[model samples]
Target: MTDDRCFRIDEMDLDELRDRTRDQTLIDAFSNWIRNFAPHVDEVIAEISAAFANNKLRDGIGLFEATGLDDYASDEELRRLRASDEKLDWKRISTADLSRCYCSPSFFDPQGFVFHLPAFLIAELNDEHPYGFIDRIYRTEEHPEGWRALLTNKQRVAIIAVLELIREHPDYQHELDDIDASLERFRGAQSMG
Candidate 1:
């Protein structure tokens, strides 16, 4: 395998991954992956921008908020939406498990695959630094998969933080909590593959 295709299992750290995957290369990869899966972020921005141009910013925000997407809109974006004439630099929020920005799954993949942001995230965290779970005692019959094992407290927290950021609507908070609780049953597998 090419070196780029290879990763050191020895260099893994959960704390680092939990806070933010310390590997920029991996982060960039995740950034691409997340953006690929969630195109609506941009779409929402476009709609908001169009509304502002039409001098209907308030109506636009209210309309989008009804769609349950206003929370993900950045403060600057919201401000700009309200103040259409204000010259402000509004940065788009990049979200998802891979990106440092916490995000919940807006929906599942069309192929009916379960969204595995936490799984992919833990796997990436394992690849990024040493002292990761792969080399630790968690591997065994309880976690024969080496990389996979029962979710640790830290892992749950990390995953939950990601979920808190991404949501279909603010009201879906309870559903996300339920999903997180359900995920507690799995081993910490290294990769989605």
Candidate 2:
């Protein structure tokens, strides 16, 4: 692979993220967002795990019910992924794993949803992928709290950039209204928080 193809998202700083996300394809932009938030995976997993540890409610996505897992993952991989006690190693996660994980966004906890969002965005952006899960991002029943709270400022901006790109793409013109509404909500939420 070439250097750009081999680039690791965790190694990028804010300026690199900004530069990379600008004028990129949707999948590339989503990859940048994944890289931007890659460093936080472990901490996010820890926080969510701690917050829900004592509660009766389950936290994060269950490996068994995740559609991607059922369709693409092996039983051994599922066994390994089910261990939430270990920190999430986003880099080690395969595209098939991402595909599986992304298929079950509705089952993810609000805070934990960030864990698999990059995958969902990537699958949506990539025409090669079989499934479509982008609609879940804006559906009230799936992410009722809105995406603003789940992202850091940079991450939010990156997403907005992707949404904007989607708006301009002819194939995705139908999503324009939802994209506009989400952008408005994100911008408004940013100002309030």
Give candidate 2 misplaced runs (Cα > 4 Å).
1-59, 62-81, 84-86, 140-147
Query: Alpha-carbon error at 160 in model 2, in Å?
Result: 0.4
Question: Compared with the true structure, what per-residue lDDT tens digits does model 1 show for residues 50-163?
Answer: 322222112222222212232566766645543532122111221221232122122222110112222333333323312222222211232223222233344434433333
Worst 10 residues of 1 by lDDT: 106-115
Q: Candidate 1's C-alpha lDDT? A: 0.30
- TM-score, predicted candidate 1 vs. hidden true structure: 0.18
All models, RMSD in angstroms: 18.2, 10.3
lDDT of 2 by residue, 19-84 (tens): 655644644544554555444434443443333233221355543335435466677665555554
Question: TM-score: which candidate is best?
Answer: 2
Give model 1's clash tally: 11
Q: Could you tell me which residue pairs clash in candidate 2?
A: 68-100
